[model samples]
Target: MTPEGKALLNIVILGFGFMFMFTAFQTCGNIEQTVIKSLNNFTASGYTSMSIIYGVFSASNLVAPSVVAVVGPQLSMFFGGLLYSAYIGMFIQPRVWSFYTASVLVGFGAAVLWTAQGNVLAINSTGTTIGRNSGIFWALLQFSLFFGNLYIYLAWHGHDHISEKDRQTVFISLTVISLIGCFLFFLIRKPDTSEPIPSETAEGLQAESTESISGSGTPRRSLCTQALDAFVKACKLSVTKEMLLLGLPIAYTGLELTFYSGVYGTCIGAMTRFGHDAKGLIGISGILIGVGEILGGGLFGILNRCSHLGRNPVVLLGLLIHYLAYYLIFLNIAPDAPQAPEEGTDLQAYITPNVGVALFCSFLLGLGDSCFNTQLLSIVGFLFKEDSAPAFAVFKFIQSIMAAVAFSYSNVLQLPWQLLLLVVTGFLGTMSFFVAEWKVEARRRDSAYDSI
Candidate 1:
């Protein structure tokens, strides 16, 4: 195939697949950030439910590397996405057991899909173009949030309260979209990678190829064994001072996601002040976030292409943006803002949501979020280019676990403290990059000595 065909295929296949899949999952899952909350209203803590999902997502790191190692990105994404479709189906019945079980399935799939997607982006694009490609991926993937929000707005725009049936319909719609996304994933051909990462060894590729078509000669390892080995290597790597420091920020990414997409949407956007128009406002928040992501991601690419600032600066900028956004949220709502549906009932009767302020926060959250995530993607994919799967898995594992922690505390914590924690996490994350200057300097010195 021509270079153009390969690039086109990547964009069409992965791009649409990511967009539609998230559209189905995040839409029904995220709207007003209340899906899990509503489901857990009678039986459990919403944050606990969400934490189960994220914890499962983190644990996927154990098995995802081996899966990708054997089957390659194309099949990994397809199968992982198939699992995602199944998880979405479980939402039809929102029982605790169902939520937790589905969470595990989706989490495992998320690890594979995300790990493959990142490696795919790195392998497919040139070093010069990687940032731009990453930006494109992020910007397009976020469009799902906008589309999902719009569907919510159109369907339940004027209702003061949505019926369980209406909610079921929402889940059903999302499930159909997710199923379509799984199909798109299958259309993605195995990449003929130009700049394959180190983990994509020629020997491994040959083994996979031979095994696929002919059988025999491919050494087999049990999934448990593969996962264990990957886990051990990644854990050793993860504990380095630099990695631990970097982890501080990656952890924040999860926390930020839960805040923006989880209960905050329901607490601040849905019940605060919009009244019957709350659903529409929630959808609007998604649109603003989507638009902001487009601008932020596109700008990241442009800056990478046009300037020498590289990625670290973008991380710094994202941190500041988040700080400012959180400040706005705190000013409008109480520092002790409760994110639980049960706790929010009183606030629903009384709390004032500063629409202008809160919506602005949403925009910044998306913008800043894109900046942090996109840059992180570029940096990690480049840094761990050789051991891509394990490295990416560890990084995501950090992100998922941290997010799980944050989500677990969502019900107990106040907004002010949560935002403060975010600031701390962002600082640590950014500081991690800054500390890497030493590593870069050491490498340069070693290279210089070798040349001499």
Candidate 2:
């Protein structure tokens, strides 16, 4: 194909890939709600069964990155999607093992989808453009999640009084979506091949190019070499006495991941505790989050342009808002209080001021969380190189580990304490931005001195 044709094909493939990947992501997000509803109706255990499902999925995130590296991104996604489809299908049978197995498959698929999507974004863009592209990609992915929940809600609503046949229908529909996602993988064009040049050759080319750009000036390395050098520089950025200050941001990133994942789940639980029906509250929260995400997408460029405080400060602010949102939710739930009686037992006793507070908290949670996530991506773009897919992948791997921890802990912990844990997690997450900032500053200083 001609170069223009190839470029067009590349763009088309990337767009379709983004859409499919986002769809896959939405499917993953919808699973918890689906499983919870299905299990509640099918078994007596109800919410307890849902917790087990969360644990299985959480564990899967811990292992997903390595699995993706081994399988290649495309195949990883395909396998994940196909397996996830089968897992959802198994829910038709409604055994304990089926739920467990399905949760694992869903987790595995989500991991692959996230990793592959990042890789695809990396392959398609460069420089600052990479960050912008990634932000847009992620924002849309979040939107897809909103729609996924809506789709599932509609499906459930249509079969409101779900008989065995209706349940089977839901499973079959999910399976179809998963399989379609898998098939969509074939459309993703392979990334361009640019073999890594040796450091010496890269330096030489950079020097020559620098000389050409600046007549009578000393030669400097090429952009590619500069980027590789930056990566090496980032690795050597240090975590010692002087560098300890910079390591703060990396640490904060971890904390944020823990807080966000954990608190969101806890908020949903809190809502349920406050007499809001699980179905209604989850759907509302999803809608609020979707709206927040749209707002975040619109604010991306504006936030990126604000250089006075820089990306790190913006991220910190976002995290602070998120922290407050979670705190509000926690306060509303009164975690230490005794569990309210079941639905039929004095329903009026359960309905009170606490319920209103919880609903508001859910809305805030969506808004604050979306802002923080958006800023976090922008910060990653500013701090890392264009081809920082591997770095970003590693970052996500760490985030997933933290998320898994939070998810698991939510299942095991009580209400008030879980909120406390989330707060601590968010604080730690906020600290990661500082670490990243320090590293960036140190690199700037080092680069300046190296030139001297």
Candidate 3:
């Protein structure tokens, strides 16, 4: 098969694999705070588990590139998928010790899985197609949100509490779907690296080749040495000028990711006014969020194909939408609603609960997320074409740390405080991205002139 054909095929595989795996993971996550609390009578256990996952994920990224180097991207991804499957399986029984343990393991798995995914994607895509490829992959993967949440709405819509039988059935099915995704990872074939990279990608990177990470002609070395070198490279990359500038934006994405993924849904489910209808509302929110994400992914992917369009516009759009979402969340969701449910002393919000408005916020959040994430991926792929692995590792490392911090504080801070932080972070992140982008463009123009 042609290289282009293989690239497209692999992207599809990644999309479908993640769609199935996350379909289970995301749905479970959406209900985690409520379901786990109901099962064990522990109030913040779900948030704690999520915090643990991102905490470990942050640490694991330090070594993920090295692991990918030794094991290869395909094998590394397969191992990571296996870990995710294990985490979901633990839910079938739902023990505190086992649940937390699985969360830790899944954290490690997530780092390697996402890092390897970046490696494979960078290898297959050219400068021209990178945005399109990332878009396709994101759009397909977001489908999990649709299917998984739809199932929840169908099965558990009106119920306030999930039964033991229902819990077992849901988890068992999710585990099976995740396992199928794991198998799909094993089927991926890495693209041939012997062919010359296209001029569009090679223009400013003439001195550095795509094979730099392929380890094509390098002599055999100890796995320990390779890992150490990769770790050092990731550390060094983190402090580089471009990365330093881009850090805030990358970290902001992580913060917002936590909010939309788990926090907001919990708030929707916990509001006393919603009563028994909360579960159904959460499902509807999830479905709309998916729709918004899919639309943004496809739209940005097409826009990215036009060279003059750049990425800053998309970033600005995301910033504005997210601010709007936060405003709605502040006005409608009580500051204490997410953590305490009906138990909190504070129940009054600026606006009375309205299901339609809440769902609108969810959709806007998803769309804004797609805009930030797709642009971030494209920027990394374009700027760090040669050292994609270590670059991606650095991105995840910082992003996960921020995500961990966000989750940890989710239990302590009120919704108002959290919205304030997000707004500030979003502004800073977007400005940082603009500066980094300008610097990259200036450097590229200088290089072009030098060549002439």
Point out where model 2 deviates above 4 Å: 1-34, 37-73, 105-115, 126-132, 155-167, 190-278, 334-360, 374-390, 435-439, 442-452
Give a tens-digit lDDT track for model 1, residues 1-452. 87746865676668888999998777655552455544445465556766877898887666665677667777778788887777677667666676667677777888778767765665556555554565577667878988888887787776665568877898788888988887886676544545433333211222233233222345465555656766787778787665665676677788898888775566554353545666557777777877878889778867977876566788889988998987777766655445545223434222356677778888998899988887776666556666655666677778888879988888688777887888777787778776664465566579899999
Tens-digit lDDT track for model 2 on 69-151?
44556676677667666656666677766666566566656655665554444444444344455455555456655655565
How does model 1 fare in lDDT? 0.69
TM-score of 3: 0.87
- Tell me the whole-model lDDT of each prediction, alpha carbons only: 0.69, 0.50, 0.80
- Report RMSD (Å) for each prediction in the order shown: 4.1, 8.6, 3.9
lDDT leaderboard ranking? 3, 1, 2
Worst 10 residues of 1 by lDDT: 201-210
What is the per-residue lDDT of model 3 for residues 353-419, given as tens digits with 9 covering 90 to 100? 7777899999999999999988898888678877766787778778888988888889889999999
Q: Estimate each model's TM-score.
A: 0.84, 0.68, 0.87
